[model samples]
Target: MSTATQSSGTGTGTGTATADAADLAPVRTESLAAILVAGERPPRPNALQASLTFGWRAILKIKHVPEQLFDVTAFPIMMVLMYTYLFGGALAGSPEEYIQYLLPGILVMSVVMITMYTGVSVNIDIAKGVFDRFRSLPIWRPSTLVGYLLGDALRYTIASVVMLAVGLIMGFRPAGGVQGVVAGVVLLIVFSFAFSWVWTMFGLLLRTEKSVMGMSMMILFPLTFLSDIFVRPETMPGWLQAFVNNNPVTHLASAVRGLMDGSWPTTEIAWSLGWAGVLVAVFGPITMRLYNRK
Candidate 1:
């Protein structure tokens, strides 16, 4: 009886010690409110800041996928070489002479053609659901589309520089010299920036990237080839000349060609700028509406 009673007393003591140890140990219970509201929230970024941030993101994407630059580099080089050589002999009696007329037009064509990629990019982003997150962000609604155009502006510059370098090497000289060339390039970039809004709208409307590309090509091919990029529009039929005369691309080429040739094409420049403004005014709002709805 005494031994049994001693064993019972020991067991009771062990249980008491375990309970005391547990009580001494730290018991951290985090409050749900305190954890969530730890500190003041950061200030929201303004429109320009958010837009530029997204533009930087687009630049970083090019850095990671350097192949994205092939359109700006190889495509322009090939165009300069192929057209300058092929038409130089047959049309102008020499590649050297033809390049003088062809380079500016080709520069305009190449840059404009590549602008379709903007829509393709938008479609891909939408397909991946990335824009959904962008829409949810506290940012200016149009900033996302603006950021895309800003990024593409760099690509446009790259293509222009590459083509100009090729032209210089191929005996193409600009009478307008440095100032004229700079003005022409600036004008092209501005026009391209406005033109890209059309593609952005298409991107939002189209279901697939391929569909966007197809639609862009269907529209671009006629606009580019029907213009005076390859030959004098006067040589064509009167009906064709009428279409070519009214083509915005023709006016842009004329303006750029005149600038590079050291002549101020005031009328052509005005028309080009007017067309650019019209494109942006019409398509920018449409794109934003689609973007908001999408």
Candidate 2:
């Protein structure tokens, strides 16, 4: 019995010692590498792919926090209703007649106003340090900024569509038919996209979201309100008319209004396109520089 017990104890001790020796063995670089990367690494995403990825991320954020859509939906609905009824009778003698003139302008105003939120989003992301991780990635740099604009473009579209629905309900008819209406909306969205770059630059330059918002409102209020949206620039004082006439918003509003009315205002369209190009050319570089430094 003693001999059998001794043998059993010896076997157990040897097995335990062997297990520990294996555990303490140094891991080889090859083995470690194999374990760390189980397969071939993925290729770095190209600019378009990267940009689209970030854009999708923005959309996902909206999906998770759907309340972000309130500005696009509720605010637009309110603006259309309040302005159509409030100004309709006073401005054009009747609500129905006024809607025909007001809807396109209102559409431009609402979408342009919401473009400021792109800067707000950039500021928020910077605050949360989300951008830090983005910087460390191997993707295209401008993709992040472009992604925000693309996502906000969707919001612009939503606001435009909602406002149009409300306008139609309010008796705003576009003489340009569906084709003209579509063209007008497309032009507005393009301008809004270009305009968003301004806000993006502000977002990079400003330390806080509120600061960006305040600056945007200060600039936008004058541009939108002083233009031919609510009243004709000809009715304003001479000096004020000069500013209103040159305002990019005025050109955008005029272009959109003309398109929707089937008038095809070539001068307005050219001016609007020129302004859009100028915005992207000027602000886009500044924004990218700020983004890289920030």
Prediction-by-prediction clash tally = 0, 0
Give the clashing pairs for model 1. none
Tens digit of per-residue lDDT, candidate 1, span 73-185: 99999999999898899989999999999999999999999999999999999999999999899888888888999899999999999999989998999999999999999
TM, every model: 0.89, 0.93
Off by over 4 Å in 1: 1-38
Candidate 1 whole-model C-alpha lDDT, 0 to 1: 0.94
- Name the candidate that leads on lDDT: 1
Pick by TM-score: which candidate is best?
Answer: 2
| Model 2 lDDT at residue 12 | 100
List model 2 lDDT by residue over 1-294, tens digit each: 999999999999999999999999999999999998998889999999988888888899999999999999999899888988888888889989888888898899999999999999999999999999999999999999999888888898899899998888778889999999999999999999999999999999999999999999999999899999988787889999999999999999999999999999999999999999999999999999999999
Off by over 4 Å in 2: 1-26, 34-38
